[model samples]
Target: MHEFSIAQALVEQIEAAATKEHAKRVVRVVITVGALSGVDPEALRSLFPLVAEDTVTADAELVVEPVSARVRCRACGREEAAETSFLRCSVCGSRDVELIAGRELHIKTVELEIDER
Candidate 1:
């Protein structure tokens, strides 16, 4: 599945960062996933350990934060949560609405473990 590939890429990036920072291990990875990003968070989380095994993020915890879609109506100057299937302006009932949020997948923070010894 695409989740496996995504996990592979995440592990690679985490590993590279850990190496660069001279971290003994990665403690946690905080990621923000938008609802419109078309990513299955559960599937991605399941694939993480498999891909991260033997890597710098092997034991790292993966924290996924879900983001909801927000739409802004130009006709009524109103903003509200948009339905996943149909995004229409709640106030004006217009289908022409600008997506304000959702459709993003990014790593927000990385916690690392460093060894002084």
Candidate 2:
């Protein structure tokens, strides 16, 4: 699935960062995921270990912060969470809305274990 590929890329990035920091291992990885990003967090979670196998992030914890889809209504000047299936303004019921959030998938932080020895 696409999750496997995504997880692979994520592990690669984490590994690179950890190596750059001279980390002994990775402790945790925090990522932000949006509802409209078309990514299944559970699937990604399940496949992360497989992709991170033998890497610094092998035992790292993956924390996914979920972000709800939000939109701003141009007609009513209101901002609120938008329905995933329909992108309409909740207040004015107008289709003329601008997406303010949701559609994000990025690494927020990475905790690492560095060795002085």
The top-ranked prediction according to TM-score is 2
Consecutive 10-residue window with the lowest summed lDDT within model 2? 83-92
Top candidate, metric lDDT: 2
Per-residue lDDT of 67-88 in model 1, one digit per residue for the tens? 9999999888899999878999
Residue 53 displacement (Å), model 1? 0.4
Give per-candidate clash totals: 0, 0
The parts of candidate 1 lying over 4 Å away from their true place are: none
How do the predictions measure up, each by TM-score? 0.93, 0.94
On a 0 to 100 scale, what is the lDDT of residue 43 in model 2?
99
| Backbone clash total, candidate 2 | 0
lDDT for every model?
A: 0.91, 0.93
| Alpha-carbon lDDT of model 2 | 0.93
Q: Which ten residues in a row have the lowest lDDT in candidate 1?
A: 1-10
